[model samples]
Target: GRGFYSPSDATKWVAYESEPAQLLTIGLGVGLFAGGLGVMLGAPGVFLAFGITAASLVFLQFGVAVPVSHHIALPAAIAAAASGSVIWGGLVGVACAFVGEFMARTFLCHGDTHIDPPAAAITVMTTVVNAAAAFGFFALAKLPA
Candidate 1:
């Protein structure tokens, strides 16, 4: 009798699949909260504020990985920073929606199959979450403290 062969998993694949969901959840929460504080404080809060902004922006960008890359006349570092802030922050809702859809298709079904109903629901939920975070920041900024 022969035994079935099991293939060894690669580092990236193992890491990607094994990565804790809590990490992403916590990262998003912390990023939004810190970023909100940064925006509210202004000037002096630049480090933590922009740092959170940059992290969230990158997370959203990686989540979507949209194809279009536009160039501006600003200096290289500034242009990259501005692009990340404007594009990612501006589109976080939509990007998260897409990510939700992708996650549903990949995880819930355990196959490549896509169900429109669930995908739409997930997208809407993601959009709401992103929008809430954005508006929450705006609201927090208005408070005097």
Candidate 2:
């Protein structure tokens, strides 16, 4: 049975998928930085602020389920709710922002070539976050199957 319409099993489907917050959080950080891409600019810091705000809101909205917070707009309105994953995901987003800016300054700005800092940050942080999750560092983020 798909159990989609059943109230008791409504959330069962999430078990088959990877956590949703990870990609979108990364997206928020990367997209924002990419939009405001600049050398030593305030984009990363803004990204950081978003991370804290979004995740903390998740901590507040225990009804929506933190993993459900894939959009940056949610935090502004109802937000992710709770679930430990939200905070960790927020940290990941913030980390991506910090790293993206750092990469931009260290590798892109001083160099003559155009290496996308957001792209690099996304790639590296994706791997790092997943690796940490696998190692039980952020295991709470995973939905139970």
| List of clashing residue pairs for candidate 1 | none
Per-model TM-score, in order, reads: 0.24, 0.40
Worst 10 residues of 2 by lDDT: 74-83
Relative to the true structure, candidate 2 has a C-alpha RMSD (angstroms) of 19.3
Instruction: Kindly list the per-residue Cα lDDT of model 2 for residues 113-143, writing each as its tens digit.
Output: 8876555755676566446645765445552
Taking every candidate in turn, the Cα RMSD to the unseen true structure, in Å, is 12.5, 19.3
TM-score of 2: 0.40
Q: Estimate every model's Cα lDDT from 0 to 1.
A: 0.33, 0.41
Best by TM-score: 2
Regions of candidate 1 where Cα sits further than 4 Å from its true position: 1-10, 13-20, 49-145
Instruction: Count clashing residue pairs per candidate.
Output: 0, 2
Give model 1's TM-score versus the native structure.
0.24
